[model samples]
Target chain A: MSTLIVIDQAPYGFWTGREALDMAFSLAAFDQPAAMLFTGAGVNWLRKGQRPDGVGQKSAEKNLSAAPLFGIEALIADEHACQQYGLTESTMLPGVELVSNIRDVLGDHKHVVFAG
Target chain B: MSASNLPERNNEGFLEYATDWSSDVASVIAAEEDVSLSDNHWEIIEFLRKFYNKHEMSPPSNRLFVKAVKDALGEEKGNSIYLMQLFPGTPAKTACKIAGLPRPTNCL
Candidate 1:
């Protein structure tokens, strides 16, 4: 069965979001079919030019890019959320799918998770 | 190079700044881990450093670390036993330490 992970929190503010990212990577690592959905402030994760160096954190932009190579089926972002966060097609990290109807994505997955 | 002359490290001995790393620093760290710097060890270390440069993070856990190695280097060097031999203890932790990268977050 496919798993859909949801992230609603902003990046770098909390470790839980990273744990969620790690959870998503773990699922992909095991060959469990999985996809990630970005919503709310979580869409900020899809934006490019993140430099967390001053915060002493690794760039989430770079980490998310590895998802596909590790076998994640897709990284989908809510278009409304992206608009709210000021992310455009050119501003987002490449390879992410910007979707207008996230409910359809929710309906398609057997297992859904809200990452902590 | 003496440990005293080494770049700053965290409590666990990983370099505080990745730019502080060099082959000499890797050797000093490896010496503490009881691993001599063989070409095979250097290969994995270099791969990890490049991986960090590209991804800006260490593989979060041991399983992902092996998967990443398999993805990049193929099955021969990617399997756990082969990596375990080259880097004793938790291979992810040990190798990251010597490679001058951050600790794998979920390794413990």
Candidate 2:
């Protein structure tokens, strides 16, 4: 069964969310079927050109940009979350699919990990 | 200290016995990496040691290290560029080495 990792928080503020992404990469390294869903504040992570300089943190945008190299290509961001954050598909990084019905998408996976 | 006086270390230069770690050992190793320990460097080294003591592992990567530092210290000190400036290389690797902790297994 494919594992669906749901990221519900913005990156850089807490290690938990970043750790979850690390777990996804690790799982992908082992050839597991893993996909990620960005909902709520997690949508911020998909935004393009994130600096993260003010906080002295590495840009999660960079990591997300490299996610495909780690075999994590199934990236989805919640459409409602994008709207809430006032982001359009053009504003997010490439390779992300925007979904209007998050529940329908979640139904496709057998396991879910909330990385919030 | 001379090489003979140096504490036993693994091939990667991690101290064989964590108890053998001291500011002196850290200084010697940091110097090898061309980093002179400032108060800021010491703060990160101490934090890395404590993190290893508690977690029994180094942070998995630089991103996590920056997040941990930001959470423990603050943003000004926790960012990657600040760490890269002090360590002059990968912060997680260099800091863990000087802190006498094992090389992080997952860092690349």
Candidate 3:
């Protein structure tokens, strides 16, 4: 079964969100199918040209960009969250699907995990 | 190998002085992990060294390590499973140790 990891926080403020991504990577390492949903402040993570060096945190962009390599091909961003952050598909990392109904997407996964 | 035979390292086996790291040191550490060094392994070790040189720190976690590898090497060799096959238990920890980089701080 696959796990849906929901990220709800902006990067660099805390390590929790990054840690959650780590868990996703770890699970993928063992051949687990995983997907990610970006919501709330998490949509900010999908924005392009993030320079997290100023905050002394590695940019999550690279990680998100590489998620497909880890079998995490399904990346969904909440439509409202994207609108709230003024982000469009062009502004987000390539291949992310922006969805208006997140509940339907959540229903498709057998397990769900939240990080904020 | 005993500590005396190895270069000075921190308690976790990371090099106390990164400059002291060499291919020989990496081989020794990999041997301890029962991993035979191949060109594939050397590629990652060299990559980690360059990453540390550039960033002044090892990739802080597996996610970052995967991303860094993907950025440097491309998608085929950068996936988590590919790395795990080369460095079984935890690719970031195992690779950083063999590369003589300091242990990544935020890794679980």
Candidate 4:
């Protein structure tokens, strides 16, 4: 069964999203079906041109780039969150699908998890 | 040519800065692992360097490392046996070190 990992927190503001990403990576490593959903402030993770090393945090944009390689099924962002964060198609990561119906996305997966 | 001339590395011997990497440095690191560079080895190393440049992170674990290689290079070179043959120990750890990237966080 595919699992949907939800991240609603702001990128770079907390460790929760990174841990969730690790979890998703781990799942993929084990040949499991897993996907990530970015809602609320989490859409910032998809924004391009983040240079966070000066702040002592690895760039979330770069980290998330490994998702496709690691076999994470998909990266879905909430459309409202993208709007709230000023992330347009040109400014966001390539191939991130924006979805308006979170309920439908959640229903597509057999299990759903909300990252801390 | 000399240890003193090498770029700054971490306690685990990872490059402190990925930009510090070069072909000569890769040879030096490979020597430390008792792996002499070959056309086969460089193919994976170059792929790894490119992967790090694009992803900004090492494949965090061996399985993911293999998967990433398969995604890019296809199945013939992506299996654990092929990677382990090129890199004696954990292939992800050894290749990333030689490729001048950060240590894979979950390698152990």
Winner on DockQ (1 vs 3): 1
**Best of the two (1, 4) by TM-score:** 4
Docking class of 2: incorrect
Per-residue alpha-carbon lDDT of candidate 4 for residues B1-108, written as tens digits (9 for 90 to 100):
656688999999899998999999998989889999999999999999888877788898998898888888999999999999999999999999999999987788
- For every candidate in turn, the CA RMSD to the true structure comes to 2.5, 12.1, 6.0, 2.2
* Candidate with maximal TM-score: 4
Q: Where does model 3 exceed 4 Å of error? A: B1-10, B15-41, B47-94, B100-108
Q: Positional deviation of B43 in candidate 2, in angstroms?
A: 35
Off by over 4 Å in 4: A53-56, B3-5
Candidate 4, residue B2: CA error in Å?
A: 3.8
State fnat for each of the candidate structures.
0.56, 0.00, 0.00, 0.68
Q: List the residue pairs that clash in candidate 3.
A: none
Model 1 C-alpha RMSD to native: 2.5
- For residues A28-83, what per-residue lDDT tens digits would candidate 3 score against the true structure? 66667999999999898899888876876667886666577556758899999999
**Docking quality (DockQ) for each candidate:** 0.52, 0.04, 0.15, 0.64
What does candidate 2's lDDT look like per residue over B3-85, in tens digits?
56779898877787766888888889987888889998999999887766554456656666776788788999989899999
Tens digit of per-residue lDDT, candidate 1, span B1-108:
988999999998999888889999999999999999899998999999999999987887788889899999999999999999999999999999998888887778
Clash pairs (backbone) in predicted model 1: none
Residue B43, candidate 1: Cα error in Å is 1.7
